[model samples]
Target: MSNSIATWMGKGHAAVEAPIGDDGFCFGSEPSLADVCLIPQLYAARRFEVPLDACPRILRVEELAGRHEVFGSAHPSVQPDAE
Candidate 1:
């Protein structure tokens, strides 16, 4: 499981290292479907204790998304039922 997680995160890291723009999103300056999907996957990765030290671009995207009003509001941690 750890190996698989590392492999996938490594792939994601490589993919985003160059393409991620100054806005820190997966695609463009504004959040899009890719961001919506990426954010949740990042959340899940954190929950599962997946190490993200090498995925700086992914982390940057997550941070920027968390600051967006819509995305911030929709975070699982902010839900009423969250523990």
Candidate 2:
């Protein structure tokens, strides 16, 4: 699954144009439908120890999202079911 996700994200990275801002979100400056979808996948990929060195754009979006309150609150580590 991790390998598959890595491949999927690799394709997403190559298909997406460069971000307009310093952060590499696929859409506008704020998190959009693309981010809502991608961030969770990226989080899950990390849990499975998928190496992300190949997707710098995705990595940049992940970093920026990690700093936001909405994403932070929804993170697996902070979820009510976390253990």
Winning model by lDDT:
1
Q: Count the backbone clashes (under 3 Å) in each candidate.
A: 0, 0
Q: For candidate 1, which ten residues in a row score worst on lDDT?
A: 15-24
Deviation of model 2 at 20, angstroms: 8.6
Q: After superposition, how far is residue 65 of candidate 1 from its true place, in Å?
A: 0.7
Report model 2's TM-score to 2 decimal places: 0.72
**Whole-model lDDT, model 2:** 0.73
Error of 2 at 67 (Å): 1.1
The collision pairs in model 1 are none
**C-alpha TM-scores of all predictions:** 0.75, 0.72
lDDT of each: 0.79, 0.73
Poorest stretch of ten by lDDT in candidate 2: 15-24
Tens digit per residue, CA lDDT, model 1, 1-83: 48788678767657756676655587877898988888887787777677778767778888889889999899999899999
